[model samples]
Target: MSKKDKNSSNSRRDFMKTSATALAGFYIVPRHVLGGPGFIAPSDKLRVASVGVGGMGGGDVRGIYGTGKVDMIALCDVDDSRAKQSVEAHPKAKYYKDFRVMLENEENNIDAVSVSTPDHMHAVIAMMAMKMGKHVYVQKPMAHDIYEARMLTEAASKYKVVTQMGNQGSSGDGVRKMVEWYDAGLIGEATKVYSWTNRPVWPQGIPWPEKGQTPPKDLDWDLWLGTAPYKDYVENLVPFNWRGWWDYGTGALGDMACHIMEPPFRVLGLGYPKSAECSVGSVYVGEFQQGYFPESCPPSSHITLRFDRPGKEDLEFHWMDGGIQPTRPEELEANEQMGDGGNGVIIEGTKGKMMCSTYGINPQLLPTSKTKDINVPETLYRVPKGDQGHYANWVEACIGGYGSKEFDLLSSPFSVAGPLTESVLMGNLAIRSYDYRAPRKENQNQFDYPGRGIKLLWDGENMKITNFEPANQFVKRQYQGDYSL
Candidate 1:
């Protein structure tokens, strides 16, 4: 464009990169021109923006905008082909392939951002926006690694920006009901919990595609790679299927555990795990031996985590993927579904077991009829519209400003979500640890899986694996290119 616009683009990066307080003056205009945060003329709307407007991210934007509560100011995605639909739908919103540039140029115009990128890129993108004092609503897992999760959890309050993770079930009435049930001791202090999902439903337990593909002209390959290692474009890795790879995705646990396990986290008021162990499915590449795919996640895994409680012994939590299910609790009717067909959660207490389907949508106590027989007074405020109101909840929270009741009332703000995501991903770490490989010094042609089948102890406050030193490296990955968090 014009000379003025070109200069703005060049300096936009630095402008948004600066501290939030330094950028506050630029936002006074929305007030000066339209009045303050409370001034809603039916013309006023939350100035919403997004990083990834393809896949589930597109759904996030559509839902928020569907509320007719926000102005779709800008959209950013590295792949134009993936973003085509959103661009067409929000034609008036400016577009960019790089989020940094979008933030630079649109910081003054954007009040909040939805970060719905790949699991690896979530924390960095959200951190940048939050540092600039923009509220953030990020998709689940909140972060790809434990370190990133901890940082984002802390950044939310330090920046004083409204934040929510896109684990919609966090707002669902079912989870709140479970919380109420647990509070009334209906389950008699949950000691063990299990959550499982049927996923990878994408590919896993395989080597990367041996050959590279021609990068589509519309896709900015480098920008799409973002914090991931620079590699030649691989076929079928984009649009989806990245979930099975470690560099970009958090595997099935990251993909679905947030929805499946959120209830237990809330019900028990859980914290970081003290130790984790896992067993994974194997891929038979030959007649005799199993293949080890370090770059890719295992096809399935069963991970167990123990969390120490104050007065009690500890909470044991189990996570399973790839359709694996825990033993059927004896209390349930044989015909009753275990975990909503292929996906579900179960909490076992001293007195009984409680179960639910995915996203904590359905809650039924074992022996089938306890839900109605034992009623606990509602203590928690229910999110309006249940899970469907998740998007609007953040929209209103952003409008109310951080520290307001709406902000404090968020169901999955980073404060709560970050720890929850970290706890969920700890399972992945144990899974990954089971597959950790090292080149054998004595035999150059072969590798060794030294981390397998070990109960890796964790030191949560420090974000370390105290018992398994080799697995500690996965806690925080080194960023390629210029990105850092």
Candidate 2:
């Protein structure tokens, strides 16, 4: 190895040795010698570094730090203005603009990483941390694409690292209750599931800006772009609104499905989808004039996915976004609210049905009255503090090390979240394919959307579309410059 590489490796080794001694040196002493039997030494706490410390990322930092078992050692974000709150809140944390630099310099000081970056950057940052043997807690959906999700899942095992996806609903009691109900046969065999959300609260189905503007002084536009293809800075793109664009975000499905669909996904033991098809709402510029904005996600969409179970028939799953919703179940009362009024889920079985709002909150059986009538023993373990315990779950697991009991209790480990994320991104694949345009064989001027009006068969193990080669583009995207899995 080169001299610099050797020296860096040596430094990391020395730091790790020192940290190990500090963490365990007192273990040899009696309980009373350390003040009390239940006392936790300061060195025993998990040290964490956060990336993209703004917006939802900031919330993640607070959740993890609030556990009181973690030390916020480092913070990183491309936008200083956006990260101001987190920076001021954790004044002791060493801050950096680029996560790459922070991870490189603080590799031995921190035991874990919290990645709350944009969808495109999640995989790259989390993958790097895992490769360095640092535990990782990544925001949902776990990755930007199916391939990245798969890789992150595999890396977690290969690296023997503790991992969790930021889908707090996985730890919610509502989902646990649903799981127990399904196991007790209250809902029978679920044949279909419907999930919807009134998302894209951000802009979507619109054309890209015609011109560029200078970025805010505190923002590092290039770093914010990360793995996405180069684009000139535009106003209102920072802090929010990136969700509508294909390059930096995964659209509405990516933003909400992890929380809304996770309950059913966990309750049903769902795997990769067998097939996917979708229809998108269009934007109209004038009377009878359709606006083609391929760069942005559609304003609305309804996606149908099929999954094959071992003994039963295929299960059909429907996803609706952009204020769209499934047909209200007759069992639901006319006056009662459905799925928190805006976002919710309904699992339909042969004999009955159950539903819940976002984050698996307020799960209920059909006929609302049946919710109280049917009671089943809780078979699944509930996470402490329910949904809010998600952060502490990861923190405790990191301190306990991989394969520990705490690690086994993680609600949304990469093993589970990876497949769930793949299922979520599968919807996006179909939606992007919906906008696929190719020249007609007979006419050079006309175009046809081949991806529409047909179902795309998927090979989950291979991560490919067996029926159409064109749709495979969405399975994995080209990483611009040095950014890659």
lDDT per residue for candidate 2 within 111-136, as digits (tens), equals 88999998889999999999888889
Kindly report which residue stretches of model 1 are placed more than 4 angstroms away from their true locations once superposed: 1-43, 287-289, 434-446
lDDT of 2 at 364: 95
C-alpha-based local distance difference test score of model 1: 0.82
Model 1, 151-219: lDDT tens digits are 998998798888999999988989877877876778787888989998879999887786999999999
**Per-candidate alpha-carbon RMSD to the true structure:** 9.5, 8.8
| Residue 297, model 1, lDDT | 91
* TM-score for each of the candidates: 0.89, 0.89
Candidate 2 overall lDDT versus native? 0.84
